[model samples]
Target chain A: MESILRTENLCKYFGGLKAVQDVSINVSKGIIQGIIGPNGAGKTTLFNVLTGTYNSTKGKVYFKDRNITNFKPEKVTKLGISRTFQNIKLFKNMSVLDNVKIGFHTQTKTKMLDAIFHTKTYKNDDRICEERGQELIERVGLSDLKEEFASNLAYGNQRKLEIARALAVNPDILLVDEPTAGMNHIETRNVVELLEKLNSEGLTVIIIEHDMSVIMNLCHSILVLNHGQKISEGSPEQVRRDENVIEAYLGREE
Target chain B: MMDQVFSLIQKLRAKSVYFLVLIGIFVLIFPQLTDNQYILHISIRILIYMLLASSLNMIVGYTGQYNIGQAGFYAIGAYTAAIIATRAGYSFLLILPLCGIMAASMSAFLGFPTLRLRGIFFAFTTLGFSEVVRLTILNWRTLTRGTFGIPGIPLPEIVNFQISTNNHFYYLGLFLLVVMLFISHRLINSRIGRAWVAIREDENAAKAMGVETFKYKMINLMYGTFWAGIAGGFFAYFAGYISADSFILDESFAILAMVLVGGKGTLVGPIVGAIILTILPELVREIARYRLVIFGIAILVMVHYRPQGIAGAKAEGRRIDVEKEYEAGISENAVETTAPGN
Candidate 1:
């Protein structure tokens, strides 16, 4: 598998606490890579560093053969890397469609003068966002609630909406942190199906999950972390049999 | 009953063009309807406040940046117009945009460093900036004449048409207000407006979605303060005098109150607020001495009951409560799941 995103010895620290310690990850193109760990195992910290929300204390990140370390979050997004949050951060006041339309910010180019004068660029941008945003909302099965305020959506629907919003960026790779967190089994199954469908469409995904069944069923390759270090990395069968992963992450079987 | 009233408002909003035309005709024929100079003067005051309140809304209401020093930009615009018109003998046409530009540049200077500061810290910076502008105007004797102020400011002329009478100033102020509102409407409905709202909603999420939060915030600040300058320039010519006393901390608070009282996010909210607040005191001169108290009470009522102001979107207060509940629920779940691990 050809690697599209490679992090070389990434290290992010908060004073004396090593949140993500000397971790290197290589994610291949067109595959769903899973990162599984116990709570406070730096799973989210790694996502934060990869998405440029936190500047890595040391090491380098390369995306599609280009060095993109220490870039701003907006810049990373502009370069076609988009992500969702562990705690959903929807614009609660805005409509579902408006939230999706905002995801197209990097792609649109309507200047201040253009907007004031209602110029051709403004018309084109507005039309594109309206049509494409509606399409994306439909894709996520939120068409019926397109006009509804985001905060009004059910917990499962809000999770789907976040994925729809992330997909609005037309990203080359999607980094989703806990997409199924706090969801019931049915909601979790639906989310897993959605991720699988997206992956089938050739969209690479990097997922952080605590659900053992989700990681086992969805991931092409799984990496298990313990205490800010990668303890095991291989196929699900190999990881399930690994002594360190069993002791540190998945408790020993009865 | 409240739902019926809201539905009626919504219906009225649907035909807003007709209402605007009716209101326009009335305002145009208003000076003709009455020969009373005081009525025209009061009308002019409403128009000026409408401009100030709406411009400040762009920052405070729409973009979610707390600015309590709008009077600072107003002072900059007023001084720019006074200095240029009095000394350089520039026409009103030239001075108007220059006033906007001058205020906009000053806003950039202030916003660049302070916009990074969040919440009350950013608010205090604006308050501090307002005082600094007033003090500078008061102490700069050579340029401003200090306590004496710059008097005898010539009446503004547009291609030899002198704006002398209260009625004339009323028309000029109306024209400026319309221009400001038109531009604001255009910006608010477009991508720039969306970016501003995105920044206001969640800065981190907006950045994740590829909206440049800082750049958009700067744009919003400059766009808003530019109109504050225009209002100031209009004031200098309308009063035919310039003084430090006009732009004070109290003046900034007054403008903020107007935005809050009317409704922050909606276009018509500030206009309604400007009309009601500006006219209420004058209509009841007996209680005019307690004007600040009335403003305080009104704001408190709005914050507790409406939260979105008079013309704001319905159920905004309820939405906030829902968000808070959702957050609390999430935190509780987090605690339960992590309790045994720690």
Candidate 2:
């Protein structure tokens, strides 16, 4: 499979702390790749570096063979890589539809003059945002609550809205950090099914999840992280059987 | 009863255009009905403040940037108009946009280094910037004429029609306000507005959604300060004098109070705020000495009760009420069906 995203020995350090040290990851096109790790194992740090939220101390990130190292988050997003937060970051005061409409920021080009004059570009872009925003909301099954403020949504629904907002970016790769965090069993299953459906539709997904069941059931391949270093990388069966992965999860026998 | 009230609100919202037209007509003919120069003068002040507050709203309310130094931009506009009109002898038409552009450039200069600062740090920088502008105006005697102020500013003329009367200034102020409102309304309803609100809500999320947060913030600051400059230029011509004292830190706080008391995010909120805050003091002349104290109380009450302001978009509360009503309806149906079986 063709690799869509490749990182070369990416290192991100915070002074004395080596949060992510010389970690390399390769994500193939059109497959669900999972990164699983214990708390404070720098899974989020890796995602932050990938999405340009943090500058890697050393190493390069290549998106489709293009170097995107230390690019601003907006620039990274415009290059068709969108992400969600581990802690959901929906525009709480905005309506659900408006929240999703904002996701199309890069795709729209209505400047001050165009907006003030109500030019053809403004009308066209506004219509596109409204129509496509509605479609994305419907896809996330939040059609009934489109007009509702995002803050008013249930936890699971908020997560869905975040995914819907991320999807509005029309990204080639979607980096979802802890999509199923704090979800009930049913909600977790729903998210798993949603990811599966999206993967089948040809989106390259890189998910950071803690639930072993979700990783085992959904990911085509899993990368295990312990102490900011890759402990195992393979199919779920192979990772589950790996000695390092076993010791990392269930500690070594006394 | 609740349903009736909701329907009534919906009907009012649907007919809001007609109501706006009626208000517009009233405003258009207000000077004709009133020969009172005091009322006209006060009305012009209200209009100018409306412009200032609304512009500041774009920064504080929409983009979620706290800019307490709006008076700095206003002073820049006024001084730009005062200096250029007196020395260079430029037309009001030319001077107006120059004033806006000058202030916008200053805001861009200030915003470049400080837009990265979050919360109170950014706010303090703006406060400091406003003071810096005022002090420069005061201390730069060579250019600004020190505490003596630039006086005898010629009345603005449009094709030989002199804007000397209070009524004339009121109309000019009204025209400027209308233009600002029209442009603001258009911008707010479009993609630019959505990006601003997104940044205000969550800067990181806005970035993740591909909004260049810094660029947008700078744009927002410039657009807002641009109007402050215009208002200041208008003030220079209307007041027929320019002084450092006019654009004090207190003036900045007053404009901020108007936005907060009236409502920040909504366009109409600042207008309402400007009207009440400007007119209320004149109406209560006996308590005019305690104006600041009263403003403090009003802001306190507003913050305690309605932090979103009077005309704020109450999406969260309104939606929750609707959901409650829907759940109640379902429970009612359940009770009705069980009663028939019993």
Tens-digit lDDT track of model 1 for A64-83: 98999989999999999999
Give the C-alpha miss distance for residue B211 in model 2, angstroms.
0.9
Give candidate 1's error at residue A8 in angstroms.
1.9
Considering every candidate listed, which one attains the maximal TM-score? 1
Clashing pairs in 1: none
Candidate 1 versus the native: TM-score?
0.94
- Which pairs of residues have clashing backbones in candidate 2? none
lDDT of 2 by residue, B5-71 (tens): 4466457657989978988999999999989888888899999999999999989999999999999
DockQ (C-alpha based) per candidate is: 0.54, 0.34
Which regions of candidate 2 deviate over 4 angstroms?
B1-19, B315-342
